[model samples]
Target: MNIIEDLRARDLINQMTDDEGLENHLNESRVTLYCGFDPTADSLHIGHLLPILMLKRFQEAGHRPIALVGGGTGLIGDPSGRNEERQLNEENVVQEWVKNIEDQLSRFIDFTDDQKGAKVVNNYDWLSKMSIIDLLRDVGKHFSVNYMLAKDSVESRIENGISYTEFTYMLLQSLDFLRLNQEEDVSLQIGGSDQWGNITAGLELIRRTSQEGEEVKAYGLTVPLITKADGSKFGKTAGGAIWLDEKKTSPYEFYQFWVNADDRDVVKFLKSFTFLPLEEIDELAKEVEERPEQRVAQRRLAEEMTKMVHGEEALNQAQRITHALFNGDIKELTKEEVEVGFKDVPTFELEESEKGLIDLLVEANISSSKRQAREDISNGAIYINDERQQDLKYFIDENDRIDDAFTIIRRGKKKYFLIKHV
Candidate 1:
């Protein structure tokens, strides 16, 4: 199938300009397209997955994809999706965020010199060089204040007050597309549905700024905003944002995020994110309907997505950790495995000379007090290194260490604690 057809079938195309014409243009040759990602955080959340996946689809379909890192725009913050003005980050902080985001994006798109391979560009390279006077005379004049104010991005923030810096955000974004169209021959811009206004503004800029009848055609496409079936936002848990970086989000937690996908949203998520062919997806859909308790589809989704972002080794470690934790087989795990497995769990450091099991448990917050810790130990609710430790006076001394440095403590059935020798 053609690119547009594939996108539509997968429900990736939320809004687009002239679908037929864009498809015809795309099928002709290796047409260049771009999607801009602003570094709002050090790592991308699952909400950013749709556009990145869309870019992957474009590259697979023989179109060149340019992943634009909005180093310049990130400092200003795009107000498209926010209810109020965003807190602007510092230049140095945004630059660091840009580097982190670029490194993460590189994992997904091929950046080789092949005809349709992806490329990365930073708008700061161009946007930073433009003088204020030149910017106003060359690009700012094309967009009137009335037109800018009418945009939903600005309109929604009227009561809260939008700044001039933010007000010019659309113009800066438009210039990125105009520049890419001129320099890289990029003809399409893709983003989340919230970016529809900014994407269209870029298209309009390209239309008006290009030479007369030059046929510098460009298109805009957006993916639907990911939301929970129960009407909550995606990519968020009670803990916080689900980051692509392993340091920011443990692989186990990331896997759990997908494994816990609502029964209603799993089918749509599979189509939107995974490259599994339609037939295989259809079969999985049937399996989901017939036996959701098996959770075959959910497992596949979690595995595919986790592997894509975190790599095979991390996925394996995550799965192993999950199984080990669930089965109460903590002793079976190696020191390295314990480290990776309990990376997200609460931890405490104890000097071998200073503390025993009771003091350690209370300090780690596993119990309210030393007396409570003693009571739990007597009640058989405490396990050390996967063995029941029922003695209150059983101090974790040097011999109790696994690998001579660490101790694992479990309270009840679900809570875990790690103690390290200083």
Candidate 2:
């Protein structure tokens, strides 16, 4: 199938100016395309995966893709998805974020010296150099107040409010497209569905600004807003955004996020995130219907995405921890792996003198009272390191610790706590 057909099958295409024309153009030539990523944070989250994957998809299809880092535009944040104006980051912070974001992008798109190799361009190169006269005389003339106000990005914020800096963000993005098309011969732009207004605005600027009878053949496409079948936003957890950086969010946590996907959303996520062939995904989908209790589809999706984002070793570590936790053998986790796996679990620090299990429970607030603690031990409802501690007199010494650092406690079947020896 053609690229458009492939994207259609994966449910990646949401809003396109003209898929037929773009498809024909792609069929006839190796068109140059670009997707802009704003470094609002130090790292891209899991939600940023779709468009990066979209760029990767095109690069694999022999198109030269440019990953535009919005070093300039990020200074004034995009008002597309925000209810309020974004507080601008210090230049130094945004510069650091730009480096981090570019490193993340390198993992997905090929940047080798091949003819169709991906390229990274920062809009700050041009946007910072342009004067207000250049901006008004060239770009501002093409955009009228009524037209800009009608766009969803501006219209949604009219009542709540929007600042002049953010209100003019679309023009800045349009400038990026125009600059890239002129300099890099980039003729197409891709982004998330929230970026539809800006993407089309870029297309308009490209058309109107063509110089000396030059014909402009630019296009825009935006991927769907990924929503879970459970009617919640994708890539978010109780802890917050699932970051691509291992330090911000561990590889194990990232893997577990996909592993725990609902059966309903697993197949859809596989199609959107993985480059797996449609046939293989279809087979996995069939397994979801036949033997869902095994969670075959969810396992496959988790493994594929984890490997894609983190690497094979990280995926293996995640699977090992998952199986160990399932079999009640969490003692198998290493010190660092344990830290990554249970970072969010409730934890209590144990003083050297306070090693007795009953007192520790009372102090850690794991038990309401000493009476409750004794009764819990007697009923075999208290566990030390996944081993039931029936002795009310049991004392947890350094010998009871895993790696001399941590000891897991289970109050019951589901509730878990960690004891850290200071």
Candidate 3:
């Protein structure tokens, strides 16, 4: 199927300016498409994956994809979906973030192919060179106050009062489209649903600045806002956003995020976030229906996402940690794996080299008191490093420490605690 057809199947086409025309344009030749990512933070999160993957889809379909890092617009902030004005970041900070986002984008798109290789551009290059007088007389003159005010982005912020800096963001984005169209032969702009106003404004600028009889080829498309079946926000957990950077959010946590997808949302996530064939996804959906207990679809989603973002080794590490935890086999994991697997588990530090197991339990708060600690030991309810130690006189010696650094303690079948040997 064609790129548009595939996107349509995934329900990714939220809004397209001219459906038929854009489809024809894509089919006629190798069209160049651009998607702008404003670096608001040092790392791109899972929320940015849809558009990034869309660019990949186009590139794989024999088209050029330009990943635009808004080094300039990021400084001003796009007031697309915000109620309050964003704090303007320092130029140097924004530049650093721009570099980080560009590096992240490079991991997904193939830039080696000479003919249809992807490109990464920063709008700061051109926007930084243009003077204020040049911006007003040349680009600003084409947009009327009424046209700007009519936009949903500006209109929604009217009551809250938007600053002139933010109110002019649309013009800056439009200039990007016009500049890219004229220079790079870019014909399409894509973004999330919230960016519809900015994308359409860019198209308008391209058409207005063209020669009197010129036919503008620019078009705009946006992906739908992702929503969970349970009505909670996507790409968010109690800990925070699911960051693409492994340092920010470990591969294990990222894998867990997808592996725990709701039964209702798993199929939809497979369609939107994964490159799995439609036929394969359909089969997974059937698996979800027939054997909900197995969670086959969720596991596949987690594997695909974790491997794509972190790499095969990281995926394997995450799976290994998962398996070890599920089977209560703490001794099989390495020190690094223990840190990732039991990061949220309660922890206690041992100042001395050894201590009696009963006293250790009471001091670590594993048991309420010395009496309870003895009772827990006698009842075979206490385990050290997954081995049941019922001996009331047992001591936590060097042999009990895994890798001579940590000791895993369990109260029952599931509750786990970590003891650090310092």
Candidate 4:
């Protein structure tokens, strides 16, 4: 199947300009397509995944993909989804983010030098070199005040207020397209649905710059905003954005995010996030319907996404922790794994002298008082490192610490407390 049809089957296309024209462009010759990523933060989050995966989809279909890192335009943030002016990052900060995002993007596309292989390009290469006069005289001529004001990005923000730096973002993005079109023979641009205006502006610039009557070979496409069934935004939790960086969010935590997908949303996520075949996805949908309790589809989606983002080794560790948690078998995990696995759990420092179990419970606030602590132990509801500890006088020792790092204390069935050693 062609790229458009494959994306169509997955319900990924939110909007496209001239569907037939783009399809013809793809069939007639090899097309180079690009998706811009502005390094607004140190790591790209789950919101960035759709475009990243789309680039890979085209590359796999034998087309050249350009992963455009917005080192230049990132200085002026895109106002596509924001309601107010963005706080611009320092050049050095954006530069550092550029490097980090570039590294993460490299893992997704084939960068091997070849016709269909992907290449990472920075807009700063051209955007940074142009002087203020160069920008005003060259790019500023193509766009009129009326044309700029008509775009949704600018129109919506005109009431609240917008900086000229942000107002000029579309023109800068359009210039990136023009430059890439001239240099790489690039013909397509893709982004989230919100980028439709900027993408079209690029196409218009390419058309006008090509001679008086020549056709603009380029086109644009966008994927829908991933939504949640519960009317909440996807990729958000009590913590924050599900960052792609392992340092910001551990592989264990990342895997758990997908593993806990809402039953109503799991099927849609499978289609958008995974490269699994349509038939396989349909089958997984059936599994979701047949045995919702088993959460078969959630497991498959988590496994696929975690493997793609974090690789096999990290995925294995995540699964081991997950299994150990469910089966009360956490003793097998190493100290480092324990730290990553329970990074957010309630924790207390274990004093060397104050190691008695009853005193520990009261100090850690796991029990209301000494009375409750004794009752909990007698009722066989307390566990440490997955082992029952009924003896109220049981003194915590180094042996209880996993690899001499930390100890897990369970109060009742689900409440867990982490005691860290000095």
Candidate 2 worst ten-residue window by lDDT: 110-119
lDDT score of model 3?
0.93
Q: By the TM-score metric, which is better: model 1 or model 3?
A: 3
lDDT comparing candidate 4 with the true structure: 0.91
Q: Write the per-residue lDDT of candidate 1 for residues 1-422, one digit (tens) a residue.
A: 88888888988878889988888888887888999999988889888888998898888887789999999999888989788778889999988999999899988898887654688989988889999998899889899888888888988888989888898999999999999989888989999998899998898898888888787689998899877898977898988899998888888889989988988999899999999998898998998999999899999999999999999998998788778877877766777778877776788888765467788788889899988988999999999887889987777887667767678888888778898777
For candidate 3, lDDT tens digit of each residue in 1-422? 99999999999999999999999999999999999999899999999999999999999899999999999999998889889999999999999999999889988998765645678999999999999999899889988999999888899999999999999999899999989898889999999999999999899888888899988788999999999989889999999999999989999999999999999999999999999999999999999999999999999999999999999999999999988877767798899998898888999999889999998898999999999999999999998888899998899989887878899999988888999999
Candidate 4 similarity to native, TM-score? 0.97
- lDDT comparison, 1 vs 3, better candidate: 3
TM-score of each: 0.92, 0.97, 0.96, 0.97
Q: What C-alpha RMSD separates each model from the true structure?
A: 2.4, 1.5, 1.6, 1.5
Name the lDDT value of residue 237 in candidate 1.
91
Q: List the residue pairs that clash in candidate 3.
A: none
Two-way lDDT contest, 3 vs 4, winner: 3
Per-residue C-alpha lDDT of model 4 across residues 38-80, encoded as one tens digit per residue: 9999999989999999999988898899999999999989999
Best by lDDT: 3
Least lDDT summed over 10 consecutive residues: which range in candidate 4?
A: 109-118
Off by over 4 Å in 2: 113-116
How accurate locally is residue 307 in candidate 2, as Cα lDDT from 0 to 100? 90
Candidates by TM-score, descending order: 4, 2, 3, 1
Best to worst by lDDT, what's the order? 3, 4, 2, 1
Clashing pairs in 4: none
Model 3 TM-score (2 dp):
0.96
